[model samples]
Target: MLKNSLNWIKKYKIHFIVWALFMLYETVVIGLLFNLYGNPIIYIAHYIVIVSIFYVHANFILAWALRDKTNVIWRLPFIIIIQIILYILLNYSADLILIGLNLIEVKGKHNLDSTFILRNLYRGIYFLGFSTGYYFLSNFLSQRKKTEELEKEKLEKVIQQQKTEQELIIAQNAFLKAQINPHFLFNTLDFIYHKVNMHSEIAGEAVIRLSQMMRYAIDSDEMENTIYLADEIEQVENLIYLYQIRKTNDLNVYFSYTEDVKHLQLIPLVLLTLVENIFKHGDISDDDDIAYINLSILNELLQIQTVNLINHHKVKNTTNSGLNNIHKRLCYAYGNEVSFQYQSIDQHFKANIEIPVKLLKLPI
Candidate 1:
């Protein structure tokens, strides 16, 4: 009940302010009337009883009565009837107590007279008007508050989503940087080992190619997603050449292009990582177990298809970090514009990737 009262006060602050002013006016009127009659104690007692009755009506009966959802015509009459009944009882009690205390002489034989009924009926109408006004005011303010809260929540959600995207970009940049270090170390070791064994001068060319790859990676780090197709192709070619020199078994790679690729762009290192995964787990041997790769760009789309025979005797020891990283990069860059599929059937491993050229193109 105390909680309800506090809530009511907060909700009806304006109404309370107006009610306080009116109560002050009533107090002044009572003081003047009592001074004219020279009966201060009787007037004080009378006001105390009236105030107690008004509190009960405002806080309990009228507060909920005005909140009813019935039609206005029905609600008005119902509330008026209830207020009249309660006020009649209150006035009768006040009169009996005043008579018992000899505060006033009873000119009438009984309290239930026409004058008593008419006076209380007028008071009931006044109370109904106040309650109805406050009811509408409270409802309007409550709805406004709810609307403001909803708007604030929506704004907060949008801000949080943007923050999450920024964090994802940062994390992806870190992962890309981490990937570069290991790839560089692996390729460099292969080149050096091959040079020492075969006594070939190709190791000097490999060092220059590695330097160029490192420069590209460093320069591209500031960019968000896309990189030139020419740059990606160059990296893949260099890595393939390094593999060809290092492996003892027969490994073949074929490269063909239909047109100049100056207009095309793609996620940096995307194709290179796929080719790396192929070399990492694929079986490159004699006869039917050779690796094959085909890449083409036409009609504003990049198509990559790779096939290699899987060696069941070979144990798979690599983590999926490279594939997972590329997948995440694709989603961040092109969303659903890129499609990837992988399958192993009858000892042959096949992978296909298609990326929309429009997404990879530089903005005009």
Candidate 2:
């Protein structure tokens, strides 16, 4: 108990110092104004009670009343009235005790009458106003600090994004220069796939899926700013199928989509990147907790959402660069018209993306 008291005093030493100075100033001002040198015991007791009321009202009662809730209008005033009544009664009780013990002298019987009650009531309201102002000022400064922090973060992100974009441009140029001829690549894959099929059909099917995914990647570069959304969805389906083959169809994952969204055009590779992140960092083998991917158009906006249980073992070694890349591309292509949000909640990794259907002409 003694250790806790020492810690509390240490933490609030500044507050103690400020209050002591304020009390001294008030005492000196009263003495100079009316030459009324008050009883030390009475002054100490009164100041202690007022200080308690200040802290309790600001940090407890007012904080509770202002919390996000319903019917705050009636609740706040009701609580304030109750506190004022309690304060008046407490002051009256304290004075009666002091009078009984002869620790203080009452100059007149009026001190125990309505006049005294009214004075205490006014003091309670006065301190309550001070406490409320303190709470609002503290809250405003805290919010200002948070806003500044967020703006700083945004500035740092913009710098990092510019760097990433430069690196991406260099990487894309290198990839194009090093790429093998499309004709030679497809021919070789087809030939090998036929020979493999003669031996093992499953192995041949895997090669076919691989070839298709490669073709989509290469063709997306040759296409204009946008491709049919159906083409992207098909590649995603093929990728999932390839994973299913690898796991011998043991994986528990579902992909759903509406027919209308497939025909619409949008940036290529965004959905594919999201799905790849899932496969790289998600646990898809749990039968009781299946992963899900959904695609649809809502109110003229294309929506893509994915939810999966995180593979803790895999996530430890993984980075979210893939998700960040998707965000960069979408923001570049669609600007503020696009929305992409992802987070881990309740042990489940979830991502949601929405873009206006009209803004499908740009590329990333």
Question: Candidate 2: which stretches are off by over 4 Å?
Answer: 1-178, 361-364
Tell me, by TM-score, which candidate is best: 2
lDDT of each: 0.66, 0.83
* Residue 214 lDDT, candidate 2, scale 0-100: 78
RMSD of each: 20.6, 21.0
lDDT of 2: 0.83
The best candidate in terms of lDDT: 2
What's each prediction's TM-score? 0.42, 0.50
Off by over 4 Å in 1: 1-200, 260-262, 313-319
Model 1, 121-145: lDDT tens digits are 7765665566555556666788999
lDDT of candidate 2 over 232-261, digit per residue (tens): 998999999888986889999899999988
**Candidate 1, lDDT over the whole model:** 0.66
